[model samples]
Target: MSKTILEDAIQEELSFFLQAIHECVHTDFNCNRVLNNAVANIISSVVSGKRFEYTDPLFVKFMKCLDENIRNIGTANVLNVLPIVRYLPGDLFKFKQTLRNISMIDKEIIRPFIEDNRNNYDDSNVTNFTSAYIKAIQQRRQEGQNTNMSDGNLETCLRDLFIAGSETTATVLRWGLVYFLNYPDVQEKCFQEILENVGQSRRPSMKDKTSLPYVEATVTEILRCADIIPSSLPHSVPHDVEFRGYTFPEGITVLPMLSSALHDPDLWGDPRNFRPDRFLDTEGKFQKMNEHIPFSLGHRACLGEALARMELFLFTTSMIQEFEFRPVDGVSPSLQGLPGIVYRPQQFNMKAIPRAK
Candidate 1:
């Protein structure tokens, strides 16, 4: 049953991906359009009680929305970091106002159901996460159980999931592209490996990963070098713990230095260089390293990791197979990433020459 559900979810997500790709390649796809489309798609899927599929329009819109929202939120976060902008009296107010507006929109969308459930909650329309959560609350209420679920909690969870999942993945992709442009040899080697292993007729699938060592290595290297999220979300140590004779007090905030792990010399030889071969064994099989923790490790690791990996594999392979990325004219691609809650490549232009079939 669990496998079935997981498969269904994967199918649904793929449907949305297809739609977004269609828009990305054919339409005048901008950041906003992509984001709005993805949002609409996710909402529709939840409402319709259908499993996500790659061909679904909702999936397409969801991907677009996901992409655009990342770009917007990333920009806003960077601007907010400026000492002058941080001090601007109006900026905080504006941010709060914008957040309130978002909350209002969310409330309005779910209001009708809330009112209907004030006395007796309905389950028919509970397809998405919000509705599912509401239904769970209602079911507990019907059973005469004390339910502590609140609108505030629900809204916060939903907002975080949407924002984090979207922005982090998009930011990673942006950095990956920048790295590819900076190191064309690495990109070419990756493309060749993918073509030789996966073939050109059908798109590369997750199962093909084991057989495509070079491609997998390149992806790992990209994540390691990108280090999009340098400081992971704060994690509590739970109880007092000792590491290397140093005692860490209980309840103290522990910031997992993700970049340090990624760049650890013990695990990676010449950790500073962009070397995909580091992840490949003598037999040309993909090797997993303990230091590669971009999605992080332990219980609080990213929930959307599987989905993100699929996206990275497909999108990167597809784009590189189709285009030869080079630094535009005299302008060199910036290796220095713009720091934010998420690190991103500074706005850089690249010339993409379409590859001949």
Candidate 2:
């Protein structure tokens, strides 16, 4: 998808999200649902060539299922190590529910979309991810070049795009709010930068990213502190390899612990602190760090890194520009995270008091 399309999707959904927040002004509210809704639509727009309204019943139900699975998957993940546990008489670890969730999602949401795209498959009309994948499979079949690519793979890849795309990006924004509540000074700095560069008269865009170093640095710092997927998805060694006197056998599972690099004290002297200045250089410019790998590194890194980064900057800057995130009763939320496929922030509530435009 073109950056313009993605940006436009975000800008439109952002208005709805801000309006949702506006309704809850001065009242403590958790932004989890609204955030997931907005992020999901943005991703769906790119992947499916459509975006669902936040109030759409089917879309709302799909999001609920997705959220439930995300929460339960941490416990259900044990099924991978102890497959026998899944045979237990009940959904103790929520493994069954997770499977059911995926099935329902495919049946009600993803499958219909894929089928529609397949029936109306067009090479020239390949505008979105789903259409593009379908066209690839069609071309391969015409050339009689059969391989692993199939409809199942296309469905699975689409699922990955939605699940991984929405959950991680939304979770990071949740963490950003947590930090904002904890450190209003940092939030104020970010807003001041946005106000100076983009101004209150208009929303911040990717174009403003270059001029607003503090806002960029703040988002960078959020990703660093959030470290949503601390241990990235499991990777397999292509071949036997030796590094630092350690031999990695071919096809062995390797869980790259991103937290090691993200939170390494050696990389940042005060890595534990919520300091955005760490991402800013001596000249107050946003500085990229090689060790800062919240999205992991190399070929296996998160596929939606660019989209995720764009969402973070636009959502965060827009939020900071519109409102002041303040803690409830002057009490900040816990910094503790619930461990899962994606490290999620503890459930917390805050107020998004609108700033003077």
Candidate 3:
């Protein structure tokens, strides 16, 4: 798709999200409405073979469940360590229970489809990822391969993909907006670059990203400063592995601290500041840095990296090109990151003023 087309899709998706939020806000005081709207949009986009939109009903429901689960999981972590909280619980244990309920709902959504197509597969309705996987499993089974296309495994994979992709991307986008509002200079620079390089007639494209080096750099810097995933997902060492003259025993849970590496002063000069220039060389070309790995690294790196990158590039560029982000009057953008499974900007509001030309 052309850059303009992709951007239009993103704008539409955002509009849908806002509409969903507005429609449900009175009835649903919790953020679950917003979450559901976002997820539903994604689901509709994937299923309908259109650009992802967050306002779709299914997506909104899925997002609500996902958000509840994430919050519940976070609470569970706290309660596991702080026994007092668990013992005196009214809503404390309920949080973990909510996660279980969400998990059951996720399985309910995915399981029936897998079971129905376990014997005979239909390729006609290959809109969602679950359907695609079902088709693949059927094909593999027909080829005499003993593939375990069980409902349990399929549900697990789908659940993981949904949670991993939706939460991470959404959190990053939230942080990007927060930063843009806080740093007007940076935001204006990005807006000017997008307008000058891509123009209003067309939306920003991945190809245009090369010409718009500063825009790309701004994104990289946002990811760097945001430090979305502070630590890599836990992994057990396969065997006795020696790294930098330190030998770690097998089966030891290893947590690679990504924040330190991304923000290391030695690796990135003055890493704390929000400097997009750090991602650019003297010649102004986008510079590749080893310290940059917002999606983690190695075999366990995110499988949705391509999709996430496309979403980020399209959404960030389009938003900046169309609107100037600034903090609401008398309100300062909160830079404090909310502690969660993925670190994200605290709740903040910004005015998206339409850009003329």
Candidate 4:
């Protein structure tokens, strides 16, 4: 994406969040849907060249599809490991239905957007990613080269972009707010850092990331405590290897068990505790740790890591700068989130009192 498009998306997201916070002040509200809408629009613009209204039915369906897909992916089913198991009676592998829904939504909805972009393909005036993609495909065709670039592949790519880009960051931000409500002192410290560094007059940007160490640390802690993908995506042993008296054979699927490292008592003195200071040195500067592998590690790591980090910083900082989050009715949410392929906090509501400008 271009710099201008990124700036516009950031500004638009900030605007939506500010309005949502204003509406939730002194009242109980679930910020998840609103936050999802804002983040969804950013990815939507990149994939489809336009944003959707929060009230749009199609957008809601898209969100539902994304949610179901994530939930199903997190689930373990015999059918997942063996396709033959799917022939068994009953909804033993209901997750397959969820996967099918996702494919249907992508084929029915996202494909049309790609088609429209291809219809309006213009090399000089490439407005969005879809158009740019079409140009690339056309260019490859001109060379008579074998390419995997097709409408089906394009639709799948678009679906992957939205699924990877939208939900994960939004979930982190949602968990960020939950952490803020759980630890007010930490939240206040983050707010103060934002105020001191970026001020309340302007929205927080990626440029201000370095100036707000406490905010950065707090976001890091949120990623740590949340451990969104506790088990992480599965990996395979390339060849026979030995480690710690264990030998794995080639082509053997392995679970890296990231939760072990993330919450290891040795690395983090109090692994269960929410302490942003764990990521900060005595000098109050942000400290880096190899143990902080929220997005996994190595070559197959998330392609969207840069975008996710940028979104997390800007969104978390802007929220702390603009509002004071508190649990509704003096009730705190459970830290033990719903277990799945990706862990997420239990459904909860909060009050977002606007900070004094």
Q: How does model 2 score by TM-score?
A: 0.95
lDDT for each residue of candidate 4 in 223-335, tens digit (9 for 90 to 100): 98888888777789789999899989999888777788889999999999998888889998999999899988899788878777777888888788888888888898888
Clashing pairs in model 3, backbone N/Cα/C closer than 3 A: 4-203, 36-60, 37-54, 37-60, 39-59, 40-59, 40-60, 41-53, 41-54
Encode model 2's per-residue lDDT on 1-357: one tens digit a residue: 578877887898899889888999999898998999999988887887778888899998999899898788779879888999988898899998989999999899898888888788877777678888888777888999976887788789888888888899999999999999999999998888887778999888999999999888889999999998888888999999998999999999999999999999988888889999988889999899999999889997877888889999999998999999999999999999988788889999998888986
What candidate 2 gets wrong by more than 4 Å, as runs, is 119-122
TM-score of 3: 0.82
The deviation in Å at residue 64 for candidate 1 is 12
Question: Which pairs of residues collide in candidate 4?
Answer: 74-341
- Candidates 2 and 4, the one with greater lDDT: 2
In the range 1-357, model 1's lDDT, one tens digit per residue, is 122333344345545554454444522222333323433334333332333444456456445444444445544565555635645676543444445545553554334334444445446644355566777776898899987797777766655665665566666666777778778778898889877887677666666777778877888888899898988887888899999999999999899999889988877768889888888889888889887899899899987676667656665776666666666664556888887567877776555555666
lDDT of 3 by residue, 1-357 (tens): 233443444556766555544454223133334543454455335423344345445545655676777666766777667767755746755655766666665565556545544444557645455567767777898998988776577777766766776778778778788778778889888888887788898766777878988988998888888988899688888899999999999999898899888889998878888889888899989988877998888998877776677677777887777666556674656888888788877776555556676
Per-prediction backbone clash count: 19, 0, 9, 1
lDDT of 4 at 76: 31
Comparing 1 and 3 on TM-score, the stronger one: 3
- Ten residues in sequence with the least summed lDDT for candidate 2: 119-128
Which residue pairs come into collision in candidate 2? none
C-alpha-based local distance difference test score of model 1: 0.64
lDDT of each: 0.64, 0.89, 0.69, 0.82
Q: Which stretches in model 1 have alpha-carbon errors above 4 Å?
A: 1-89, 92-98, 104-147, 150-152, 330-332
